[model samples]
Target: MTLTAFLKDRLVYIMTFLFLAGFAILLFVLENYRYPGLIESGTMVYIAVFAVFLLIIWLAADYVRQRHFYRQLQEATERAGERDGAAIVNNGVTHEQKLVVALLQEQNAAFLNELNQYKRQQELRNHFVLQWVHYMKTPVSVIDMQMQEVLRELPLGEEAQREAAQSIQEEAERMTRGLEQMLHTARLDKFALDLHIRRRPLHEILRSAVNSHKRLCIKHSIFPRIDGEAWVESDEKWITFVLNQLIGNSIKYSKTKPGSKNLQFRIKEQNGGAVTLEVEDEGIGILPHDLPRIFDPFFTGENGRSSGESTGMGLYLAKEVCSRLGHSLTAESVPGKGAVFTLTFKPGGIHVME
Candidate 1:
């Protein structure tokens, strides 16, 4: 590509030419073989002049040809770097250069094909997960219904029977929640397509989420109290899901404590029309090291391991859903006091459908 480098590549030829010229000069100067007419021969001078002219012409043409090929190669490499499957520029390409370009193009095509195949496989896996969760829900629902019927038919004075029935119902509820988490986790990859955002009353969404877990809350002696009101711009369904996860965690962790359990929900309007919804629970709070990584998927910390009921996906999914909905989620906790999860909705954060 450079003149110095090009000349270095032809160093052998230059050296051979120089050696032949030196041999001819040595033969001409040798007294025993020298002809008397050699010095006076103008033909020898003409031959020397012609050979020099040819050498100059050959070097100039070679340089121009090599420079052209290298320029095209450089341009093709740049284009390939910018985009996959870019066509190599082949103008004025030598035979060897054409073969190299063809090889590079074939490799690029193969790489792109492989990348697309990987994406397809990932999509298929997610689809299968969603389908499996849906199918499993049918059987879970049937079991819950059968249990409810059995519970109702039991005699009124049978406390032991009622307790056993309630335990079964609780286990069934846990399964349902786990299934829902899986379903949502699978759908997270396609969250953009499923999102519907609008301005909705915060209290209504919170109440709906709380009611969904009413039985569990009563079982754990965890009382929920919602105070204050503000309309938030968010996806109602996703926000409810987020609330459910938070409330569920609160009830779960607080149930082990001795004191009266309380879960409080509050909404406050900030300056510039932003709203913050907080869920505070009187549960054993997060450990210092685990608090920061609580939202990481499948990262169950000390409390989760102790409870033996954490999938570690709930908070992770809640955080992701909030992010997609253009809201912020945060948490604060003291070791044994409690943990408060906050969702902040900024002004004009949610897109309202017409």
Candidate 2:
């Protein structure tokens, strides 16, 4: 928009004027060779000055019209930087300038969409943290009560001491689960940075996860069975965490039954190197309406309300982790019988970094 820049851009017009004047001078020279002073030198000079004046007037008009586009564009860019995004300038007179403006408008719209989505996610994360803290207090209070009871009953009988210890252990396990959930929830956002993908044996992962819940299984009298095995390419630590959530939910819901229940881990290998692991449990199953939305954050259904124990984050985190790892987690249930949670691993899901 500066005068120097405008003159440089219109340099072609000046070159055209020079070419026209040179042709006129050559014609005058040839005519004078035949008829002396037939074309006067002063007339040629007057014509050249007139051309220069016209060129100046044309360039001035163009500069005035085009500078508005540049000025508007500069203001919009500054506003965009200040406020997450802004509307693009629309003062362009030429097609090329209008095209550039339209492209910028599209980019600005996309940026605003992304910013709004990010804000919503942060809000959800903050709400979840508050809920997690409130839920954690239950286990803490129970542990405190158990410790005070043990201290009050000094010189207790052997059976009484064992019972007190078991109660304390159970509450401690609850606290441990809550703590792990919170930690895993925090890590979920940084999942890509913290994962190493490789081939892992399905049976080993199942056994390790089952063993971790052995105490809870014993207390609830639930028998865990591993049916089959396969090799899957996945992040061991993250996949294991996912398994833990599924197993925990199974044991929790199964404990509501009368007698000993069965928890099954069925592994099936599909065509084209795909594998599926199903965690099925004999529990008070999910209602039909709630099954579809179990993976949604903080969506505790009828069973959760009745039990008064579900934070509704375990399945949500499991589904999220599965999605990011290029696997899929799904569920199905018959309200009275039990529920089955499936983890599907496709052949192409394996990602290796070299």
Candidate 3:
């Protein structure tokens, strides 16, 4: 690489040359004592010139060979940076250098192949999760319908029977929500392909989500109140899922509170024409330490742990969905006061259908 390094590599040859030159000079000195003109001989001068010529040719050829190998190595390194191992072709370099390059290329290929295999396995697992969630949904729906019918048919005086039926219905609904959460979680991997954005009435979306959780709200003695309205552009299904998760969280955390258990949905239009939907809950609020990491997947905080039923994926999925839809989701909470989640939709983004 460097001139000094190249010369250092040929240090043995240099020492041998020096030793031979010294021996010749010593012999010449001894001969000159006997023949008096040996030191001035033209034959000795010619031999010195021929040795210098041969050394120059050998050094020049070695330099050229080493420079070529270095250049090839530089090119190969650049190609490797681009993840293109195929570009690393062996030029007539030393066998050791060529072997090293071949090994590097093989290692790169093996790594890439392993990465692709891992990706394929992950996809298959996700596919299976999606399929299983969908299949489970049918039975859940059937059970829910049957429970509703049974509840309606119960005698008016049968208080215990009604309560038992309601409990079963509530558990079934929880299972249904859990399954839906799993389905959404799986679909999150390919969210772009499944998303369909459109203009929708914010009130209608809120109402649907509220109705879905009405039974749970009643069971928890939590009253959901809706206030204000605005039109928003969003993917309805995904937004509804987000709303359900928020509402469910409110009901879950606020259920143990003594005061007015109010779960409120308030929509407001900002001065910038952005619409903000707030889900305010009088819940056992998030701890100060856990507030920042609430959106992190599978990170159940103190409240979740206490509940014994939190999967910790609800808020994470909601935040992700909002991000994909180009909306903003934020939270504010005091440890014991309450928690409020706000979803903001930008102005002019929602196509208003007449």
Clashing pairs in 1: none
lDDT of 3 by residue, 112-176 (tens): 89989999999999989989998999998898888899999998999998888888888888899
Candidate 1, after superposition: displacement of residue 11 in Å? 11
Off by over 4 Å in 2: 1-157, 350-354
Cα lDDT for residue 198, candidate 1: 75
TM-score of each: 0.76, 0.62, 0.76
Order of all candidates by lDDT, from best down to worst?
2, 3, 1
Deviation in Å, model 1, residue 171 alpha carbon: 1.2
The alpha-carbon deviation from the true structure for residue 122 of candidate 3, after best TM-score superposition, in angstroms, is 2.1
Model 2: number of clashes?
A: 0
> How high is the CA lDDT of each candidate model?
0.84, 0.84, 0.84
For candidate 2, write residues 1-354 as lDDT tens digits: 578876887788779887987788778778877998787879777877887788778878988889888778767767866653346486578999988878877887888799899989986885687578667767677876777677566565667777777778677777777877886787676677788988889899889999999988998999999999899989998898899999999998999898999999999999888999999999999999998899999998989989998998989999998888889999999997999999999886846221
Candidate with more favorable, higher TM-score: 2 or 3? 3
Each prediction's total of clashing residue pairs, residues at least 3 apart in sequence or on different chains, is 0, 0, 0
